[model samples]
Target: MPPSADPTVSVTLAEIARIAGVGRAAVSNWRRRHDSFPAPVGGTDTSPQFALSQVEEWLRRQGKLDEVGSRERLWPEFEALGDRDAMGRAIAVAGARLARLTDKEAGPDDSAGWLPGGTDLSDAQRSLVERAVGLAKKHGARDTFDFLLGRWLDTHVRQINVTPSPLAALMAEVAELSRGGEAGDVGTVLDPACGTGGLLLAAARQWAGTADVPASGAPLRLLGQDVDATQAALAAVRLLLAGRSPERESAWGVDVRAGNTLRADPHPDVRADVVLCNPPFNERDWGYEELATDARWTYGLPPRTEPELAWTQHALSRLAPGGTAVLLLPPGVASRRAGRRVRAGLLRSGVLRAVVALPPGSAPPHSVALHLWVLRAPAEGGTDAGAGVLLVDAADVQQEPSGGTQRAGRAAIDWPLLHRRVVSAVQELRTIQTTQTGQAPQTAQTTPAAPAGNADGDRPADHAVVPVIDLLDEEVDLTPARHVPKKATSANLGLRRSWNRFGTLLHELRDLTATLSALELSGEEPAGQGTVTVGDLLRAGALTMRAGQQPADGVVRTGDAPDDAVRVLTVADVLAGGRSSGWLTAPDASAGENAGGLTLTAPGEVVVVGAHRAFGAWVETDAPTVLGSQLYALRADPALLDPWFLAGCLRAPANARQAGTHASTSSRIDVRRLQVLRLPLDEQRRYGEAFRRLTAFERSLREAGTIGGKLVDGLTDGIAAGRLPGNRP
Candidate 1:
């Protein structure tokens, strides 16, 4: 029957470009230039598809295939299955095969027969199964599936969603910490909507890593449920592999059931010690009407529109006394009108322990930063719940120098640093919680409170301890940014140090002012100077404009060489005006070669943001960084244009207005259409120099303002604390 249709195992030109780690144009060039390149086996003229195997063979012949990972190699076959259900089943089957092999119950020859559904595997399915088995043998089943599942999700991120790995790790850490200093002990952990089981896997790994936890003892009990049967099956396989030991066939306690957790509780009687979940956001049809009277809505009946709140209550309901549940939720759920009463109830009962605001790009529906709701089931008579909620603004906790280009909105996070900060903050909050409850403080030294109440207690930077009574108002907004304490008391020595630095900055600012005054400038441009559109410059060869390509969600592979790491410059980096902000290592050469249409900036290239608030910057660094998507790079012909002058003109208000008019949407602008003054080369250089000096002056002003602000705050706190003289001159 037409060779069983070959499962339509083909990739489009764009996918080919990604596989090759080259621009689409480069792939097109290859098709035209190479006589032996694979022919299109399917698809339309506009988007031709080539057999994946044939293309890979061709790439391998060209020595361009080394960078492709095994996970990536299998992705095309999975996609060829055509339906997500089918794909999920195939993955589950592969996971089952791996599990069998790990248990020594199946040989390599029995892989196809080990498929979970008992269906005879097709040729394409068998090939995928073999590849998966190989990967499992090499990387272990849990890691192999993790890689495969990550690639699958990356390929269909818009269609399917899972918690980002770093966030899942953070949640797992918080959940463990909430066990109240019970070192090396992990009680039962549950994830209501486990998806591909990232959180559950994290919990299992955490338990395994604990030095004090005995590996020979009963394995950690892990319970999970998912609406998708395929996901639940995959989760079970992962747990089985993760918890498996040489002495045992499987982990002692692992129950991952298919079906909705909210609709049908698989482990209704089991109250978990920790509940960690990254629930789906903005789910509309969450059985609200049917479950309106369900007993789990102990806080309040979650509004029909607020399914996230339902998830919150579900998690809280599953918590044992003094058990903690950490849920990753949308920021809007904290302040949305529909969920206000539910939020208020949560606060009043003291179940909500802390709300930590993570930076954007932590997870999908990635339009805004997500919040972590750290909660505890109230003890009998509410004795365990603390008086105040810990609010931590961790949005700034991920600052790290990185290299490589990323998509406009997706900034790379320093997971290790962020995790440390988060863990430390949580520990600090625990200490504060203990102190507020009249228990002796464990971490920090404390003095008797001043009788006059002139000084505030010691507070961690970016964290606030707001009493529950204060949060029970009409608008119980738990946003960390809204409630962060404004001032912090400092020691006399620290205040003096800050004042000295402030004075130095003030002196520098004065010097900068004098330098700026010495520069001669005309109020208006020369009368005869004419303006030209950026389009004109392109046609005249004054500059070349290129838009950056949107990068795939994770790991860009280049070749077989393990050290092939590349840095990407992001829009955030461009805004920050120095150094690369993120980088990704190519898992293989094909992806590494594509670089997602990223162009390296030569000195004198100008980069401009293509969305939201439009701005531009001149490339000054000699180091190479790939241009991120959502930015347009303009490499000026040095003989005809000056980089700084072009950048300054592009960033001007008039050009921004011109760009706005040409915008397809209110937020997206075509930087190519911006207007520029057609000044002579020499004149442009002069303007460029002037712009450079102005930027320096602006930098000085910002420094002065920062130092001045810190000076005032330090002096004020010092005076109030009786550490500095209050007498004024």
Candidate 2:
């Protein structure tokens, strides 16, 4: 079967640059300088789109077309169609061809109705399909299609709601842990809103990685449905390709269809052993009026504003007895006023087993931490109403610092640690359930009515096992934060580490002071070297400078921001000599830049305080950071200029005197006018190393002062309290 013809194709400047193996700036220059360049056929002035054929012809004339691979050339053509569904159809056609190549018994009519109108593909689309087949033959269909899908997802990420691969994998793992089974025992897995089949694929991979398949040879069934035809088609094709791969140890029966799971009920009577979902949030029109009387709302009628609850209930309705569902939902669904009735019902019925608050940026719309609600379809005539719900607050979990520019409070999720803690808590609850029910536990269930105690006799701050009756109050608030205690500070451990660091800093300070003392100064004045203004370096392309963005007052935030948020290097933070004091979401940081967003400060880039009397420059060695107000970030070409040397030069009083327009110290200095000493790269590096040492010496002094003060205060307080030996006052 062939996809319908798509005659026209258009491409953005970035795509043209990719096609020509050049930067986007080069493409822009070509458009501006060459009158013969193709005119914009579509799109706005800022992001103009050119006809693919015209661009291709031009590139051919320029001798750049030879650089593009056959498959690479097809992407722009696919984008030109400007229809996601049409591209999906073409991809499906390619998948079908690849499937037939691997499995000779697969009939030619396998993808007969996948394309629209049973029409033959246009020459351009046919070329794309053929190219895909060729690539698939070499790298394997699964890998080839995945590469293409990755590109597609990257392009339309903002438009499509995607479950990130990591999060999807975690969900699958958790579901498997709850279910306690080998692949053979799991009969079916269902995802109602299976966008691009991420969850389904994860489920398949998780199951395959577990124990060996049964000798019975019955394939694990993967069922999915989505509202978007194009996404559904893409998912179907992807699953089919994965299923046909020869390296797969276990068999998979994949059936993905295009239809609104909520509106049409595609798999109405089909109950699944496991259900995994990251359902759409805050949907106002999720069949509220017509489906008001729907039987799936077993808990209660979901408020119109509470679409996530509707999806949760639907998942429950489709679960086989003792089946488990793991759903990622917005945090609000746990405590919102409108969803309380349904939440209460779920808890009372013992269906809602656990609620885990994941760290922010764990899923889409990355500004807020999302919640995962672990659910179980009560076993036939077995409801653990007395059993407790587990509340795991893993929101504060972060990646252990790898000792570079990684800062404290950065929202990096420690996925492996989170997995272990969450799994342990759930396992303990399951054991409790088994003991109470007097039956062998086949799936994870709620804990016994009594709250479990730890070996140390202290409840862990990260998780809590609370009885359902305790959660049946008026609000029925199931927010994990509400139940789990705040993480306790390791004061003793922290104090010990701080004392160690203080000792190290003191040792370094002594060593550095001695090194500085040993420095011999020239007796006579030496001839001064020629100097160049920062503007001159810019013209010579030795360095590029960018000013810190003055984000709106409320935009620069502190405390519990998402993991994707950027650390904002502000003047105050620079002056105070500490880590970033504020954070900005990536989109907000990059909001108005024509080049797509704010450029982060790379390692060795120099960031200078642009205003204030204590003007200074520091070399950035931390992970990438976004610049905030009253700061200047300079990125020097290592071949032409040393970043540390440049930073040191900018910090000189002579440069400040020349660059500063006003006598007042608070006035901003003209960074472009700041002077740099001209020298060869090798000489610059020598000076750079000296400057680095000087900077470290100063930092050690500050650390020693701060630590010494804290240490002295602790000693004084201890003596005053008679906890330490001291002379009597």
Q: Could you say which candidate leads in TM-score?
A: 2
lDDT of 2 at 572: 72
* Local accuracy of candidate 2 as per-residue lDDT tens digits, 1-729: 122223377777767777777766678788889999999898775557788778878878877676324445567766665676667667666766666665543344445455222325666666777767766665666666777777677556566788877788888877877665565677799999998898998888776442233324567788998888678777877776676644453367778877888999779888999999988888889999999999999999999999999999999999998888999999999999998999989987988888999887677777688999999888888885535887888786656444213473365666666666676677776666657764432322232222454322122226777877778898999998887643323223335556887888888988888877777888874577689999999999988988766554555655445667778776776666556656766544544233333446778889877784657888887746776666778888877998889998899988887798796747888888899887888999888888888888987787678777877775565556554345457
Clash count, candidate 2: 3
- Estimated TM-score for each candidate: 0.71, 0.73
Stretches of candidate 2 above 4 Å error?
A: 1-69, 105-127, 134-139, 180-183, 209-216, 246-250, 407-411, 436-461, 486-616, 620-645, 652-669, 675-694, 697-729
How well does candidate 2 match the true structure, expressed as C-alpha RMSD? 8.0
Candidate 1 per-residue C-alpha lDDT over 336-418 given as tens digits, one digit per residue, 9 for 90 to 100: 88888999988878788889988766677554788999999987565465747877777754433222212222245556666
What is the Cα-based lDDT of residue 100 in candidate 1?
68
Q: What is the C-alpha RMSD of each candidate to the true structure, in Å?
A: 7.7, 8.0
Model 2 — TM-score against the truth? 0.73
Query: In model 2, what are the clashing residue pairs, if there are any?
Result: 10-80, 405-622, 405-623
